[model samples]
Target: MKAIHLKTLTTIAAAMVLSASFPSYAAEDMSKMDMKTPMPDASAVTEGMVKKIDKDAGKITIKHGPISNLQMPGMTMVFHAADPAMLDQVKEGDKVKFHVEKMNGALTITNIEATTK
Candidate 1:
């Protein structure tokens, strides 16, 4: 009877140890953690004035015209560009029509050409 009791205890201990050693795959769904949302590739076009420029930081501030994101009913306000290179052909008080696109995690101007207006 003593041997039987020891065997039962040993079996229970082994079972517990084995269960604890491995991850609990049966309890929860692992697929949800790996899932990610697909974001759209959207670009913005604006006609604005260059308010500030920082060449080192790759950023430019623009007093944009009629920014829809701010619910702005056509007002002049400052915005930061994802790339400082956008200011290469532009400077303060220069009138330009810039095309900004979302890349990586920031809004950058992919195409910036000079305008006569």
Candidate 2:
């Protein structure tokens, strides 16, 4: 009976040692942290005005004043859209609130619908 008690204590001590060593080697997963915070998903967007539209080049030159993600050191300039078809409903001097996305190095307008009051 004394030998059995010694073995049980040894097993308990081994288990405690293993439990203490496990968390030290573990790392926290950062994938859950949202670094690319998304903006409000709404069609009610009413901002920016169109500066230029070129049908021949299939692109539009938007003088985007300031965008949330477009935060940079220099002033705003013209941006190119992959699909000029997005400009079908938009016209020069028309106020719009469009959202752009970068896909494979090209900045494209993913959403450019009209905005209501």
Candidate 3:
């Protein structure tokens, strides 16, 4: 039927337009997304031991002390690093002091340093 054909054409056109516009839409969506939890203060850095490090993924697993700013009690959890290059300074079993924040809806390490003392 002509009505069915017209509906199919409309759906296909809409899909094409959406696909073509998706990248911009996604970028805008990211900017508009709300973080449910407040970010931890940068000044309230925490000390932790690196349990794992995935350089390729820019993530690290740490067993940390209490993060008072975020109201997070110490536990081991994985976090994305703000700068992948900082991953180079750390390895598993190393002690580190790091800055954490709620970045793009997840807890992220914004600053990090490896330490022995």
Candidate 4:
């Protein structure tokens, strides 16, 4: 009985020491904890031409180059706008740089800018 009690205490102390060596993110502010996907860098932006825009549907169709962040090949596809006003920033046939990510099970354009080329 004495040996069993000593071993249990030693195991508890070891666990406590191991746990202290790691930082705890759970104690941080929940609001600051962004569980969403990380924002892509400027280099991750894909060049594309706007093929269509439907403000009412809040969607944009783009014929874009390979998206490195997504590991997606160059293709034309419809994407949801993170903000409906994003659709107003470009018209059909405009050349643009954009960032896209999967959000809520849908492909969404998080950032977009019109380009002269």
Off by over 4 Å in 4: 1-40
Where model 3 places Cα greater than 4 Å from the true spot, the runs are: 1-43
Candidate 2 per-residue C-alpha lDDT over 1-117 given as tens digits, one digit per residue, 9 for 90 to 100 = 345688899999999999998764323555555543343464322256677888777676666645555443223456566566777878887777777666787665666655532
Ranking the candidates on lDDT from highest down gives 4, 3, 2, 1
Per-model lDDT? 0.60, 0.62, 0.85, 0.89
Model 3 CA RMSD to the hidden true structure, in angstroms = 9.3
Question: Which candidate has the highest lDDT of all?
Answer: 4
The better-scoring model by TM-score among 1 and 4 is 4
Cα error, residue 3 of model 2, in Å, equals 46
Alpha carbon RMSD to native, model 4: 7.6
Cand. 2 TM to true fold: 0.50
TM per model? 0.46, 0.50, 0.62, 0.65
Give candidate 1 regions above 4 Å deviation: 1-44, 67-84
For model 3, what is the error of residue 117's alpha carbon versus the real structure, in angstroms, after optimal superposition? Answer: 8.4
**Colliding pairs, model 4:** none
lDDT of 1 by residue, 1-116 (tens): 33568889999999999999996765357754654322223234567777677777677666666634324444454444544555677887777676555577665655554565
